[model samples]
Target: MTQNLQYFLIPFMDWRIMLLLWGGVFAGIWVGAIPGLSGTMAVSLLISFTFSWEINDALAVMCGTFVGAVYGGAITAILLNIPGAPAAIATGMEGYPLAQKGEAGKAIGLCTTVSLFAGFVGVAALAAAAPIIARFALKFSPRDFFLLAVMGILLIGSIGGGDPIKGIMSGTVGILISMIGMDPSTGELRYTFGSLNLMAGISFVTAMIGLFGVSEALTQFRTSGAKSPKQNLTKVIPDWPTFKKYLPLAVRSSLLGVFIGALPGTGGDVAALLAYDQAKRTTRNPETPFGHGAYEGLVAPETANKGAIGGAFIPMLTLGIPGDAITAIIIGALFIHGLRPGPMLMIETPHLFWMIVSMLIIANVALFVLGLLSVRPFAKIIEIPKSIIMPIIIILSVIGTYAIQNSVVDVFYMTGFGVLGYFMRLYGYATGPMVLGLILGPMLDSNYRRTMQIAEDRLFPFVSGFFTSPLSFFLTASIVFMLFSQTKLYRKWRGIE
Candidate 1:
């Protein structure tokens, strides 16, 4: 443990590593702030570039990018009414309203300060509790995972806010869309209409950019002479009293972010939305207002979003399962370096895990510094002509989608999803559920099938699990409670139950 702590503190010990890590942080912030560019894309692209580097160096760059990108998304969310990443969708709901009110700088400051604090909470949680959480997570089986996925799906109530039914429909559509590729069980085509390219399924990143980026750009064009909101930078520092009031909420959101982030198939977006919902529920007085410029609103999502960085690494390091897309990309990086991430990783490369933790610490600090000094500059980006900005967004979306695999088919898929996204939004549907479903659908399908296969081989043990194992029983109960909680009958019975 003492030796492991040494690795966790290595970035502090080595100035060169810390400098390189911070450099990546700066680059990631800029990349992620741009519309249509994502942290996942940035990290994935970096993998090829870092292929020749040492394992630790490669990981440092990836961690920096991950940390920076998560926070970077909020910049666009606040200034442009566009979420740079899906995790920032919640941020846009509240942050944009603040921007419209000419408090972009203050909002950015509040979010930045809380984001840094939340990142620390997440890292601290991971450092202290990863092994324990991993142990608990190991007890969950496919049924539990499936139920958890359903719970995630049900979260659209808070995510959608305006219309719960629309959220459900959107999530269902996302699940259906997720089924577009090859069938998990039979390896046969399901929704692909005989096109060779369609067999692989829709790209989530393209869909995200289309739904949140291009669609938003199109919406912007509908209003002529839309001047960029005047962004004032006079008060870019967080007030102490305001900070003190929300510190508890920030801590709670950060913890929630970590917990949700550690769960395989659930990522930062869900964590952010969940944190937002919880914060809204717990607020005694949401300053600025709930959905429009509320300081708590920015704090909740921003904290949870950044905190999710550490939370996401828990399962990745302990179980070799990625908690999010960015970590999935990191897994590839690890494999390329002949490093396996799992329980064995803890045993074999304990130092590597600690290095990642250290990288996160440095990256968060770097993000704080960069975000503080650069808030004004970033807010100024909103002043650029939409005609110029939107076109660039479209081009970047095209390039980023193609860069995934150099496939032209992805470009067409992206355009198709963009069209679909436009329609979905028109019908009052929330895109967050769609993003969540797309991410978790494949994971649920594969795991459920594997569990069933194993069950058939040992029916007695599988059946007995519900009665014999406390973990299984608790998970089953939780699923039942979640399902019941979402029903009209339960709602009426409990009068908003």
Candidate 2:
């Protein structure tokens, strides 16, 4: 224990490492606040040059980037209705509304507070229950993952506009669009239509940029001359009472994030959405409506995504299995650093494990301090006139779209999507459901097909597995319960909004 303590304190003793962490975090915030730049993309880029650096120094920057990027996404989601990443989609639902009401600072203040709490919760879970959680994550099969996607599909109603039918329509279209590329198991194309550009499939980040960022810019043109909200920047940190009020919800959401993040192939995006939906289902007589400016809406997703960062590391550090894309890349970094990351990693090199944990804690602290200090300026973004800001958003959207793969076609796709989103909004269709669909659609397609292949295409056997496998049964039951929860009878009984 004493030696472990020493290892944990090593990062703190190195000023150069600390500086790298702080710089990486500060940079990550801006990167994640932009529409197309993502934490995964940023960290992947770091892997190339960091190959020759000391392992601890490389990891310090990566760890800080991971923490800051997740937190940074909420900044733009609140101020501009453009979520920096899919995880912040739910944040925009309430946050943009709050921003419009000139409460951007307060919303962000609460978000930063809960995010810090959630980050610690995830770190605590990593330190205490990583092996257990990793073991649990191993129980998930493709069948269970398919069922999980089905559960995500039910979130259509929760994120939908006032009209559930329109939301369903939007989500359905998104799912269809997700099927455009080659089949997961087979080399055959389903909807490519002989186009080279369509072969790689549409990137969800590009879609999200167009649907949320560019579409928002186009819509703002209708009221271009109207003055933007004069944001109130005072009170950038939530008071103790305010934090206490959200304590239970934050704990619940953060734990949920940790578990979801621990799941292989899942990330903060999925965790945040599920947390948002759960919060919507459970909160009673909320101070504001779920789709409006509800503080719970902000708290749940922000906390969950932050918690997911630690949760993601749990598996990567202990089990050699990456929880998400970023960690998968980190695994490659581990290999480059001449470290074997697996079941015996901690036993072989205990200092690495302890140092990573310590680094994350420091990163989270940096995130909170830096986030609070920047709230005023970030909030001021909402005060910019639409005519000036809208064009800039579109330009950034285009630049971000192109940067993803350096493809000119992606720029066209983003512009097309932006136009589609604008029309959808004009017709009372919320873009949220569609974005959810895009995120979950591929998961549903690939997992369902994998389960089918595993069952040898035998329908009866495939159906039986859901009933026979304990994990599948649980996920199936959850899906059933989710469907049932949408009914008026359940809502009336539970008194959920």
Models 1 onward score TM values of 0.86, 0.98
Question: lDDT per residue, candidate 2, 1-497, as tens digits?
Answer: 99999999999999988998998889899989998999998999999999999999999999989888898899999999999989999999999999999999999999988988999999999988989999999889999999988888898988996899999999999998888888777888979999988888898889999999989998999889999998887777889998999999999999999999999999899999999999998898999988889999999999999989999988998899999998898899999999999989989998998999999988988999999999998998889888888898998898889989999899989999999999999999989888888889999999999999999999999999999999999888888888888788998999874
Query: For this target, which candidate reaches the highest TM-score against the unseen true structure?
Result: 2
Residue 490 in model 1: lDDT: 64
Residue 403 displacement (Å), model 1: 2.9
**Over the full model, what C-alpha lDDT does candidate 2 score relative to the true structure?**
0.91
As for candidate 2, its clashing pairs are none
